[model samples]
Target chain A: MRKIFVCLLVFAVVLSSVALAASSIEVWQIHSPIPEIMNAFDWAAQEFEAETGIKVNMVRIPTEDLHTKLVVSISAGQYPDLLIWNIRPGLEFQGLGVVEEVSSVIDEVGRDNFPTATLTMFQAPLGKQWEIPLFARLAGYHYWKDWLLDAGLDPNPTVLDDGSMVVNAYNTWDDVLETSKKLTKDLSGDGTIDQYGAGFQYNRKGFGDSAAYAFSVITTFGGHLFDSQTGEVVINSPQTVAAYQFMKDIYKSGVMPPGVVAWDGYDNNKYFMDRTVGFIVNSNSVISNVRENDPELADKIGVTIAPAHPETGLRTYSGSPDTMTIFKTDNTDSAKEFAKFLLKANTQVEMFKIMGVGYYGPLLLNVMADPFFSEIGEQERMFVENNKYFVGPEYPGVPSPELITVALAVYNGFVYDDALTRISVDDWSPEDAVKEIEKRVLEMLEER
Target chain B: MENHGGPRLTMMQKETRLGALLLMPAIIVMLIVIAYPFIYSIIISFLRWHAVYPDHPWVGFTNYIKVITDSRFPITLRNTAIYALVGTAGKMIIGMILALILNKQFWGRGVVRGLFILPWIIPMVSAATTWRWMFAEDGVVNFLLQRLNIISQPIIFLGDKQWALAAVLVVGIWKGYPLFMTMILAGLQNIPGELYEAAEVDGANGLQKFFYITIPSLRYVLITAIILSVIWTFNAFNVVWLMTKGGPSNSTHILNTLAYEYGFVGMRYDYAAALAVMTLAILAVFLYFFAKLQKVEE
Candidate 1:
């Protein structure tokens, strides 16, 4: 039994080595189990190998389990050459030593080449040039313009030589709500509204982005989660308090469906694709998901920026930048070369070609400006144009995120009637949540 | 002295040496497998480590304070306690009843006994996965209820906080009952039929016979089963994690899940360690109760 086991192990190793061969440098690209993910890796590998002498071997892990595997392996002195995760880039892996410092490469790549706002996301804390920008998203929804045009709203708002009132994109949150309310109606006479105006993710997983969305609304009312200089939670401040109260008022107004607080992030996408929900904040890449299953919606679907907050006009969009960190391994030279290669404009643009479109746009001024790409990236281009002065939000410390998640869950909690959802949320007033968040941040600041 | 055809041997010394040698490997395996993690955990419970780096900085009583004071701490402790109490009491009662039913001589009794143990033989991961599927919005559980005309709407079992923990309990009972059933069944089988016959001759009713004879015989096995279940149930991370991820919101979070979140996901290793220590302290209290029960049973 022992001999057979050893023999099998040896045989497996030989097979792997023979398949790999000697001249090719193996690039382990970490991604999700989704087929699109494999295509992304395979395309990158095939392209890179065609252009250069390297073989990229892609390892797929379920997105949820990837973080644990990365940490465990990295801590044990084994790390992949590059990693692209399902999570937003900064929150999961960037701040930790696990991500390589990408500053030098960014300098080489040139600051002018990259988007200034995109650069802000990598500023100290989440900053440092560890990740070569792959793609990024603006947190919002997709609407079927074809459906809207059929509803008497023009399909394309932007006019050609001939004048026409078309389905133009929303520039602000109010615009989204108004559009949804207009679009929403009962198709059936059952009295239960089959089509609803909008929904927000307030449940367990979706609650992660609640802080960004809420405070952005507050920013619309001119509120912020923290005082940039004083390091305080300002949820009690008049602007934020008004923002919080207005959200409660919105729920009461019934612009959204029942049980908004219990909805997960993916639920909104599901609702929108089914044409049951008129609007939602979701992953921009879900346009493909809609297109894949509902081809009809693909034609009608128009991608655009979320509605700006009515007052402050802060287009607060949450994004997860797909990042690649080259670790110090036995092959550090190759790692550096690959990191630099990944930052190349051609390579970055190649990612869009291979990975598909709509989830994220390139974080480069040069790439965004290409006339050839002008027709491909429509909404992301608008997101960039809309948030020209955008700065990536940073967590104050470790518990800052937890406190924020708890607080957002609290904000979401007001909408949920169930005790289960409520308990996950800290049912504190914005004041209480702010107070607890301040305390938690202080603890994190003191922690090593 | 040696054994036959070898060296002439005195049986006593040879038997003693052979027993010691054979047991040594088991002792080493136990120490490596069990003691190492426990000791490592105890050390970590006092120290802080970066999730990215393994070298931990010791922060003696701080982690303990954090665990005890955090708002979620009390709730998790309460949930774990409720789970243990409801779980233990449910298993003991159900298991004892099954043992009684199986004790009766009948045709197909062997097959019946084997069938009762199926849930126990199931892989925890596979079992949890199936339970999750059954609990899904359009899954089997709601279908069954709808089929029976018990409810009109499909209840979100893991998605609702009130029903979420109850769902976990339902799965836990199903997973745990067979253990007690098997243990007590063995204990029940050990008693001579003559004792039961004598009890019948004494004109004792069935309830009286159960109280005096069956209960007394099963006490040791019962205590052993209960203590083991408590330990297993307390640290059972996969089932709850895979099911609800301790949500509707953090409604289903216990210390074990919280520790993983902080240490691994949240990157607050010191805080997680502190929580581990508290869980150990709580479990120690259970161990004491088990010891007392064992003494009583003896």
Candidate 2:
């Protein structure tokens, strides 16, 4: 009897050990194509596992498949314990109520750790934090300094300490157009124009870059797709028409490459990197690519805030930051712990150092003061200074759950891009395109 | 009745029982994989099922009505029809010509046949990506056309609304003709050279022999090929989705890509489901008529 008791007791301990071993949490993150960025996440996961006895299983999903995968997983009642994605879709997930309210996580991480502007973008429906801001992705104009110098344009335009470019002929939209014409040339004298002055994707099928740039143009022109206070569909204003006209003018000016209407998210980067185009509105991915692959070209590349409105001198920079959220799972506590771990200043600094400053800007304010950021490059300074101008898709509107629906319309090629394509490719008048945009926005709003 | 442990069964009954037992696993799998999803999709089509929203209130027929009334629906449907019909027709014509040529005695016929199947053998995504580059404004297509003086200026093949669908169709035909060619070639081999020789002895010309004996012998094969090609071209999502993504003002959108846009991008699962059901219905009607025609032909 004593032998039997001993064996049962031993079995109980073994079973408990097995149970403890199984207490790992799963996290689904959109896979970055860059190896170092992915390795940084793996390192963080390993560190988290080392710190806590609980293991972290990091599942990397491609960006295109992530959204549908999340929806299917959640609907099938097999969602991960944690998810990291863009703040817009993160808010949409929160609005769906599958995510845990991470206000407590933010409190635990310390609300003051993150920048207020960046943090505010994630706090949908107000007074509640749905996700923790991971990193900021800021958009700007990436131009070749050598090309500018060759064209007799300012290689280094005066930027205010506040991160806004001083409005001048060199920085305004019209001035940029004039500069583009000067830079647009046939260096080979092959009886064909081998280079374009400027280019940005107007393709409706692009992954939100087109919409982001178009929205920046619209916002700079003093227009709002939705009223900030009322959340009404207001994309039919004269300013929107002017913005559409400006985009059409750019496409029609022979400055952009032929078929700008069909370029995808990567086309601008390809064009800029291959020296086919002198200037483009894009995120820092271009810089990161050049810095890693073509250092010579990287030295010649100049990063600045996107062009200001030729008339109003208003410059709006579209920002889509990566964010982390804890889903409502049995492993909520472990997920929350991992989120806090990711939000740590040292962890972020280490990760960003490996990821390179060109890929992501710091989310935590304290991390910005780290030597890693300070010594990075001039472009890093531009990224940090331009953070003040970072605005979500809900730029004119207050960030809310409704903003997700509005932003989805923009992201899904239903609104801004559709309007741009109508005016540029389909030959619809800007006013008519804006009217159709208004109608579509209203329909989507109604459905939402 | 036998006095065994239980009531004894007759031979037919035993055979029937064994047959059912053998089929049980397959039936269960079919139920799980096929029937459940089909029924679930049909049910979801009747509801308002946005992936993000919590409430999926049943608005019977509203989703379908909305799908029909949506402005993009007509355009997508028209585009799908043109893509299916024109793409299949092009594939059949090209495949028939190639199969006929390769059927004749020629040096390196085997090598030529192998080369013709390369497009079909290559993965669709890789082919689509390569074709996208080749169709670029400054790509090889324009370069070649300009060199030949066929056109003075470069045509943005995949970017122009007027040419996007046609470009997609060209890729579809190129990728698909191999299957038809192989099928028709097999059918040609089975035609028994005696028929062609008899037609020739009867003072029939080459076209006459082809039209009378060859075509008549290949009717079933051609019909089967056409049906398969139509289904494939109609449901083709990857090529169009990867190439243009139904862009240049959604000119290249087929039903499949549009359904993807609605379901995945727009998050309107109900509308997407409705579009899917409607597509199935349209294909079902076409197949039903095709079946009737096949019966009449028989």
Highest-scoring model, DockQ: 2
Cα error of candidate 2 at position B166, Å: 0.4
lDDT: worst 10-residue window of model 2 chain A: A161-170
Tens-digit per-residue lDDT, A1-448, candidate 1: 9999999999999987765543344454444323565675577677766766666666776545666676667656677766664243333344355556667777877877876555554444444454555555444445666556656665454632433212353555666556666766767974546677666644444444444455456556665555555556554567655655555555545556554554544556666777776656555556667667776666666655545566665554533466555665545455556656766767767776776555555667777665646666554544444333232333222224333333322333222222213323334455544444445545554553
Instruction: State TM-scores per candidate.
Output: 0.77, 0.94
Angstrom error at residue B235, model 2? 2.3
**Native-referenced DockQ of model 1:** 0.22
Look at candidate 2 and give me any clashing residue pairs. none
Highest TM-score against the true fold, candidate: 2
Docking class of 1: incorrect
